[model samples]
Target: MTQLETAMAILMKVFDTYAAGEGKPDTLTKGEAKTLLEKELPGLLKAAKNQEEVDKMLKGLDFNGDSEVDFSEFVVLVAALTCACHNRCVKK
Candidate 1:
């Protein structure tokens, strides 16, 4: 599978862990995913004060400008956030 697909799989795993079996994986609606990102991923998306901003932030990361950021975009942004966090830790 492609890198984006891999990232989507990983994202699914993350969500599954968060939801704690309260919901089905296939039935994970966009709002639920958005909620996860907005509430849980504050470090990765600092300016995401709300779900719409979170959605726009994700959209902005779409390098191909296809109006859809798949797993690749998601993973790359997460990786960048991870690196940034690590660097900050080192600096401190």
Candidate 2:
């Protein structure tokens, strides 16, 4: 599959696991992002080594500086990560 398609699939999988049977779309709430940083990305997201660190990181990615992160921003963030991990992955 293409990188864009692969990234979307990975992101959807991540969101599904986070939603935990909620059937919710792939949107990232503040809490969900924090959990992802602290738990799922332990080594990758070790800014301050805690939830507060994750919150700070979230602020930077929120773009509009809004308290919550919508799917658009979340997708961008996930795409960036995918690209970082797999150099040629995800076309943005």
Candidate 3:
């Protein structure tokens, strides 16, 4: 597979792995989302300054107000982060 294809597969795998933790098998509950962020995106959590900031970030990821994050919402989070990282890299 191409690099982008591999990345997409990895994203789906990561979401599936975490979303399977509890509740629905497709969407991420709050707890599952927290675990996924803490484990998979520890740097993001660390950069959050405080619990409130982290909470806000999570809330923002729940685009549909469903109290859970579906795959499309998760992709938005990843894409935003990727853009942020890319911009930082370009600056350097």
Candidate 4:
């Protein structure tokens, strides 16, 4: 696989691994999302201004107001973070 292909595969794998924790295999419940962030992206959590900021960020992930994040929504989060980081690095 190419570099981008490997990244895409890992994204799906990470989402699947967390989304499988409870409720449904296709979506992540609030708890599962939190655990995924806490475990998979601890630095993001730490960079938040506070717990409420972290909570607000997670709450904003639900675009359909379903309270659960689907794969597409999760991808948005990853893509946004990737853009933010890439821009930050390029600025320096």
Best by lDDT: 3
For candidate 4, what is the TM-score? Answer: 0.94
Candidate 1 lDDT tens digits, 1-92: 89989977877677565444335443323454455566678565576577677677655666777554444555676788789879989954
lDDT of 4 by residue, 1-92 (tens): 99999999999999999999899999999899999999999999988989899889889998999999999999999999999989989955
Q: lDDT, candidate 2, residue 10?
A: 82
Q: Local distance difference test, per candidate?
A: 0.61, 0.69, 0.95, 0.93
What's the residue-level lDDT of 49 in candidate 3?
88
Worst 10 residues of 1 by lDDT: 21-30
Candidate 1 CA-lDDT value: 0.61
Model 4 global lDDT (CA atoms, 0 to 1) = 0.93
What TM-score does candidate 3 get on C-alpha atoms? Answer: 0.95
lDDT of 4 at 40: 95
Residue 41 displacement in candidate 4 (angstroms)? 0.8
lDDT sort, best first: 3, 4, 2, 1
Better by TM-score, candidate 3 or 1: 3
Q: Is candidate 1 or candidate 3 better by lDDT?
A: 3
Question: Evaluated with TM-score, which candidate comes out highest?
Answer: 3
Off by over 4 Å in 3: none
What's the TM-score of every candidate structure? 0.51, 0.58, 0.95, 0.94
Two-way TM-score contest, 1 vs 4, winner: 4
Order the candidates by TM-score, highest first.
3, 4, 2, 1
Clashing pairs in 1: 4-72
